[model samples]
Structure formats: structure tokens, C-alpha cells
Target: MKIMFVGDVVGHNGRKAFQKYTPKLRAERGIDVVVVNGENSAAGKGFTRKSLDELYQGGADIVTSGNHVWDKKDVLEFIDQEPFLIRPANYPGEAPGKGWCVYPFKAKNIGVMNLSGRAFMPPLDDPFQKVEELLREMEKECDLIFLDFHAETTSEKIAMGWQLDGRITGMVGTHTHVQTADACILPQGTAYITDLGMTGPWKSVLGVQTDKILYRMQTCRPVRFETAEGPSVYSAVIMTIDDATNRATDIERIYLREEEDGIGL
Candidate 1:
């Protein structure tokens, strides 16, 4: 099965780029499933129900999120009703939504888990232990598994990838909007990458306007960050897994350059 994972979708521009490029990519890569991180989908903060619906209609099969998942209060109620949307599993139990879900893929059961890292991030439950427990339950019924490790530190992401190497089919990092150079399969066959990168203007400061970020840093004053609106780029990864062995056999990074035609989506 071929699957595609998109990094953090910034805002209007990001959504447009994703919608414009995803269909072509699906055809070009023969992607069987598409997963996207929608934490910053709504005005570069958190996703709203309407935004999530738009992303789903745009070709994402599953929408994942990170620290900003709860920025929108409406999601507290909407996530439970939507089976394809997931938040970090390491979050407090009282948090809204679930950390993982299982869906039927062809004749096999596929599971997706969302996890958060504590390093340079909000304190959360132990991701390593939580993942082990969840995998044990999923292994009983599912053969294919995908992990979205929403984290900041590269060390944490790499450690988690190695920890679940042989147990899961694929593991990819998110949250940090810059793409990393490490995109390779582990010795145990799991496909991994430090980050999938941002889906908005790469010329800006991680999808935010550079001036705004600079001003805040210089003045040490409160400032609201907005998504950069300009020529952008979209980054993602496509993975092919062998169902028989539940391992990723092939992986490729996809970079889409967006034109300045007022955003495609």
C-alpha cells in the first residue's frame, strides 16, 4: 500500500497548495491513503470544524494534530464525532479526541497513532510507554500501522522512530515546519523522517511573516502571528509498505512549488 503524509498545513495558503497539489500527487504516486497534520490549518493556529471538513474534501484521508490541536474550542466536541481526525495520544487523558484509530484498508486493518514529545513542548504523558501499550492492542487486530510523532526535538523524534522500528510500518515527525534531511528506512524496515515540513511559504519564517516574527523577538512584546501569504512550497512524503510483512519498502520525498496565482485551493 502506498501512503502519503503531509506536514503542518499553515493557513489559507497552505490549504490552497495542498488542494492544488494533492490530487496530482495521488495520481502520480498511486497513494492509497493520505494523512495530513491540520494543527495550524485555521488561520495558522488550530483547526476548526469547517477547516477540517475542507481538508478532508481536499483529499486527506486522515487529519492529525499536535500542540495547537486544542486552540479552537469547537474541536473539543467535533473530534469525537469524526473518526478520521486524531490528536496527540500523549496528551492528558481528560483531553478531547483520541490518540489513535484503526480503519479497514483493502483486506487489512490499518492503525494510525498520534503522539507528542515533551522536549521543548508542553508536558505530556510518556509517549514511549503509551505507544507500546497502544501498539500491543493494535497488533492483535491490525497488521499495518502509521505513526505521526508531533514533536520539536529531533532527538526525541529519532528515538521514537527507532523504538517502534520493527513494530510499525511507518513513522514520521511533525510540528516543526522545516523539512529535515533524514528520510530513510531503518534497519528494521520502518520508514522515517525527522519532519515532513511546512505547506506554506518557505521563504517566510516557518510559514509566518518574517517581519512579524522579527518584531516580536526584537521588542519582546505580544504579537499575533499570521500565515505568510505569497509564493509557497509544499513538502510531503510517499511511502510504500508491504502488507505481508507490515514494513515500508520504499519512500520518497515530494516537494511542490506553488505559483503566485492567488493560491490554488
Candidate 2:
């Protein structure tokens, strides 16, 4: 089975890049499932209903999110209704959306789990413990398991990878918006990457307008940030998993850029 995991989509440019590249990439690579991080899909902050619908129309089978999931107040209204959209499972039980889900793919159930890290991030429940709990519950119901570990520090992400190395199908890190050079199969057979990178304007700072970020950094004062415009880049990773063993056998990083003409350059 081939699964493609897209990095965080920042705003308009991110969404456009995703819409432009996803379908073609899927066809070219024979991707069976597509998971995207959409926490910043709504104007670089939170997700909106329209943005979620756009993502679904753009061919995302499941959308995962991180700390920015709640940036939009209306997310509380529809998060529970959207089974394809999931937030960090480490959030409190009363949180609006679920943290993981099992979707049927090719006559087998595939479990996708989302977890948030505490280091340099908002205080949330212990991701390690939450992941263990979910694993125990999902192991029996799914043929393969994949995790989106939204985290800040590389240490935290790497620790999570090692913690569940042999047990899960794959573990990909998000939230940093910068793709790491490491993309390899673990000793235990799981595919891993420190980050998938941001799928937005490549010239900006993490998808934000460069000037705004630079001004803030230079002045040490608050400055509004807006999503960058112009040419965009799509960042993702494709994983090939063995159906019989439910282990990832290969992983490859994909980075495609769009020219000003809206064509992949």
C-alpha cells in the first residue's frame, strides 16, 4: 500500500499548491491514501469549514492537525461531525474532535493517529501515554497503523519514533514546517521522518510574509503575520507498506514547486 503524507498547508498559496499537486502526484505515484496537515489552512491560523471542504475536494482522504486546530472558533461546531478530520489525541477527552481514526482501505482497516508534543508547545496530556492507549485499542482493529507526531523539538519527535518503532507502520513528524533530511526505515521496519516541511510559498518564512517575520524578529515587537504569495512548494512523503506484514518497506520525500505560471517548475 502506498500512502502519501502532506505537510502543513499554510494558507491560500498552500491550499493552491496542494490542489495543484496532490491529484497528479497520486496518479503518478499510485498513492492509495492521502493525509494532510490542515491546521493552518485558514489564512495561516486555523481551519475553516470552507477550507476543509476544499481539502476534501482536493483529494485528501484524511486531514490531521496540531495546535492551530482551534484557531477558528467555529471548529468546535463541526469537528466532531467530520470523521476524516482529526486533532491531537493528547488533548483532553472533552476536546471537540477525535485524535485518531480507522478508515477502510482496500479491504483492510488502516489506523491513523495524531499526537501533539509538550516540549516548547502548549501543555497537553502525555503523548506517550495517550499513544500507548490508542495502540492497545487500535491494534486489533487495523491492519496498519500510522502516526502524525506534531511536535517542536527533534528530540521529542525522535523519541516518539523510537518508542513505537517496531509496533507501528510509520511515524512522520509535523509542526516545524521544515523538512528534515532524515527519511529512512527504522530497524524495526517503521518509516520515519523528523518533519514533512511546509507546503506553501517557499520564499517566505514558514509560509508567513518574510517582511513581517523579519520585522518582528528585528524589533522584538508584535507584528501581524500574513501568508506569503507567489510561487509555492508542495512538501510530502510517500511510504510503501507491506500489506501482509503491515510494515513500511520504503519511504521517499517529495518536494514539488510551482512557478508563477501555476505549473510545477
Candidate 3:
């Protein structure tokens, strides 16, 4: 089975790029499932119903999020109803949405789990312990398991990848909108990457307007950040898993760009 995991979708540009490329890529690569991180899908921070619907229409089977998931106050309105949209599992006491879900794909149950890192992030429940609790239940009900670790520190992300190496089908890190070069299969047969990167403007500062971010950094003051415009990039990773063993056999990175003329490459 093959599954595609898209990086953080930044905003309007990100959504447009996703809508344009995901279907073609899926068809060309024979992807059976598509997972996208939509935390920044709504104007560069937080998700809205419209953004979620757009992603679904763009071929996202599961939408995951990170710290920015709650930036939109209205998320509480529909989070419970959307089973495919998930927030970080480590969020404190009785959050609005779930952190993981299992869906029947083909003849097997595919479980997608989301967890947040505490280091350099909100002080939430320990992700290591939270995943351990979920795994006990998920292993019994699912054939394949995938995790999206929305984190900041590479060390933390790498630790989780090693911690769950043989147990899960694969794991990918999100939150940091910069794709890492180290995409590889672990010794225990799990596919891992430090980050999948941002699916937004290629010439911006992590999807935000380059000038705006520079001004904020230089002045060290509160300045509004907006999503960048112009040429966009689509970042993702595709994983091939063994059906019988439920282990990842191969993993490949994807980085495509769309020019102003609407030509993508």
C-alpha cells in the first residue's frame, strides 16, 4: 500500500498548490491514501471549515494539525463532527478533538496518530506516554499505523522516530516548515523524516512574507505576519508499506514548484 503525507499547508497559496498537485500526484504515483497537515491552512494560522473542506476536495483523506490548530476559535464548532481532522494528542485535559483515528483502507485498518512535542512548545501531556497508551489499543485494531509528530526540535522528533521505529508503519515530523534532507528507513523498517516542509510560497520565510518576517526579527517587535504570494512549492513524502507485515518498504520525498505562469514542475 502506498500513502502520501503532505507537509504543513500554509494558507491560500498552500491550498491552491495542494488542490493543483495532489490529484495528479496521486494518480501518477498510485497513492492509496493522502494525509495533510492543515494547521496553517486558514490565512497562515489555524484552520477553518472552508479550508478543511477545500483540503478534502483536494484529496486529503486525513488532516492533521499542530500548535496552530486552535488559532481559529471556530474550530470548536466542527472539530468533534470531523473524524478525519485531528489535533495533537498531548493537548491538555479534554480537548475538543481526538489525536488519532483508524480508518478502513482496502482490506486493512490504517491508523493515523498525531502527537505534539513539549520541548519548545506548549506544556502538554508527555507525547511518549500518550502514544504508548494509544498504541496498546491501536495495535489490536489496526493493521498499519502512521504518526505525524508535530514538533519543533529535531532531537525530539528523531527520538520519537526511534522510540516507535519497529512498532509503527512510519512516522513523519511536521510544525517546522523546512524539509530535511534525511529521509530514510530506520533499521526497524520504519520510514522517517525530520520534517516534510511547508507547502506554500517557495521564496518566503517559512510560508510567511519574507519582508514581514524580516522586519519582525530585526525590530523585535510585534508585527503582523502574512502568507507569501508568488511561486509556490508542494512538499510531501510517499511511503510504500508491505501489506502483510504492515511495515514501510520504501519512502520518497517530493518537492515540486509552481511558477507564476501556472506551470508546475
| Residue range 5-117, candidate 1, lDDT tens digits | 99899888888788878888899778899999999999888988788987987899999999999898878778888898999998876877888888787898888999999
lDDT of 2 at 236: 96
Better of 1 and 3 by TM-score: 3
Please give the CA lDDT of all the candidate structures. 0.88, 0.93, 0.94
Q: Which sections of candidate 2 miss by over 4 Å?
A: none
Cα lDDT of model 2 by residue, 201-251, tens digit: 988999999999999999999998988999998999999988777789999
What alpha-carbon RMSD in Å does predicted model 3 have with respect to the real structure? 0.9
**lDDT of each residue in 1-265, candidate 3, tens digit only:** 9999999998999999999999999999999999999999999999888999999999999999999999998898999999889999888889999999998897999999999999999999999999999899898998999999999999999999999989899999999999999999999899999999989888899998889989989999989898898889999999998887888999999999887787878
Return the TM-score for each candidate structure.
Answer: 0.95, 0.98, 0.98
Candidate order, lDDT descending: 3, 2, 1
Which regions in candidate 1 have their CA more than 4 angstroms from the true location?
A: 259-265
Error of 1 at 118 (Å): 0.2
Worst lDDT window (10 residues) for model 1? Answer: 256-265
